[model samples]
Target: MTIRDTVIRTLAHTNWRLALPALVLTCGSLIVQAASEDPEVVVPTASPTTAAINPAGVVTPAPGTAADAASGVVKAPIAAVAPPTAPQAPAPVDEPLMKLPVNARHMLVIDDTGRVLMAKDADTVVPIASLTKLMTAMVVLDAGQDMNEEIRIEDADVDRLKHSRSRVRVGATMTREAALELALISSENRAASALARHFPGGLAAYEAAVAAKIRALGLTHTSLADPTGLSPANTSTAAEVARIAAAAARYPAIARISSDKSSAVEINGRPRELRNTNHLVGAKGWDIRLSKTGYTEEAGRCLAMRMKSGGQTITVILLDADGSAQRLRDAAAIRKSLAKIAAA
Candidate 1:
């Protein structure tokens, strides 16, 4: 062939090759759109046993091909192109570490050395309901009152502010020791009020002593209006309440009477059984050295405990929990979080 004829043949082949892909793509798109718009029309997909297409865009059936044997029609495989992906949201900045799973409105966990391990709103002052008995017991013990001396619960001992129910009736009489147990363990309001009334100089003197004891403990955010803790005016911060737990833990009677699971004492000439207000005191898996629980409409649920965990004495103060179960759950969550920290 002449050189011009050979060049013309090569140009025609190149143009055909370039046009073939566009023709195939257009046909495939039309087939897909047709199948979608009219479901009755079947779009044949390539089968492994069908004839294959060559670079020249012609179907060449291999030996024993089903499509070649059945008919002259053979489908070409559609090119697989992935759909464009959406831009990701910058991978979320690695997400700041999750906070502890404590739900108490005020929470504080401190080591024996008074180092705060975790806290939330610990400095906010809030009403501390029956926890006032801890201070009452402390001041009464500090005064060196005769624990065996008999004190009778009177009408004055009846809680008028909250009108809280109590098993320790107004006519009941018990030793100061029994009264202390009733106050701290059962959270008996009348028993607590009787103890304050029988103080060396009565309720006024007891209030003065509580103020002095608060100052002595170096607590900056604690105030008590009554010994029974029924008044909403009795308030303290979670941090200061932890301090109070620590101070109260120092007293052997306060620790023992408060932590005792149950105590039997003579009242109204009959033996009465009083169980602790804080159920965790003797509960399994707990090593509570001292425990106190408090509640009121204004205070919600409050808990204070000096307990041993991971071989370290910890003071856990949870204030303003919604319920008893929630307070206990918050304590358990704290323990679990502490365990994770210890392991880490």
Candidate 2:
């Protein structure tokens, strides 16, 4: 082809590339506008199957799926909405290249390379306290249950394990989305119980689901008895806690909400402020992506955090700490020591 012809073709190709995104954006805007209009148009949302959920909260199969042909999922009277389960990353390989001592009885720090940078009694099984909520969030999100489903706090969720008090009082109402947020962000025992209670087969089924998930994730040394870590039975090793933290950070919902400095939700028709259990989330220069704090007489003050700062990602697990302040100090010391090792 002649140079002039080739140049013209190149320009046309460039124009197509430039215009395609603009065209898509314009069409997307129009569709959004249509959806946003008063008496909003009913747009059938697509899922893994050809099924669609109606605005009136009914599940109907789209035109030609097998479900439509059989009218199976449609006439069931109840819809099964499962969360898309994201596969877990394989367990990290142990690299005992460096050892750093900390106050905690069990501690672990894993880097993005899946290397155990530092560890102390990481395999000792101990009660994880609220860190169990990390697994709870994972199990719930893996179920892909309707996030908008309303969950009412009941006396059943009154933390029979530890009798912990929650800012979200019983008899208050909120969505599963908010419940999950409250569970992970604030480590609310009631929210955790409510999530398990509202699971397909109730708390028992939720426990089974969590167990199945643990098996699936290959957590041989980690198993939880309840949704909340209040029970001493909710136990795991520091190594496994690191793995759980890694898995939690992978989910956008868990990663996003767990790291939030603060969240606001309507409880009993009044705005309630929920603070993150991990105070490191709000500290300057500490790019924590996921955090959970737990404390019980058995679990002591425990902390699990996934930090992404200065382009480095590391998971910190501290269990059975003496006090909350001491746990924070250990974390800071660990980070400092890790930084020095990395610099060397």
Q: Which candidate is the best by TM-score?
A: 1
Instruction: Give candidate 1's error at residue 250 in angstroms.
Output: 0.4
Q: What's the number of clashes in each of the models?
A: 0, 3
Q: Write the per-residue lDDT of candidate 1 for residues 36-137, one digit (tens) a residue.
A: 989676554333222232232122222333332223222344568889889653211101112454567877666765554555666678899988889999
Clashing pairs in 2: 82-144, 83-143, 83-144
The best candidate in terms of lDDT: 1
- Residues 1-344 of candidate 2 have per-residue lDDT tens digits of 44345445555767877766655665666667656874855433222122222232112222333332122111212357989889765433222223344678877666665554555666678899889998888888888899988889999899765667778777999999999988988888899989989988888888898988787666787868788888888888876777677777778998899899999977776777889878889798688888889999999999988887436787788888899899989888877776655565
Task: Evaluate residue 270 in candidate 2 and report its C-alpha lDDT on the 0 to 100 scale.
Answer: 73
* Model 2 misplaced regions, further than 4 Å: 1-99, 342-344
lDDT assessment of candidate 1: 0.76
As for model 2, its CA RMSD to the true structure in angstroms is: 23.3
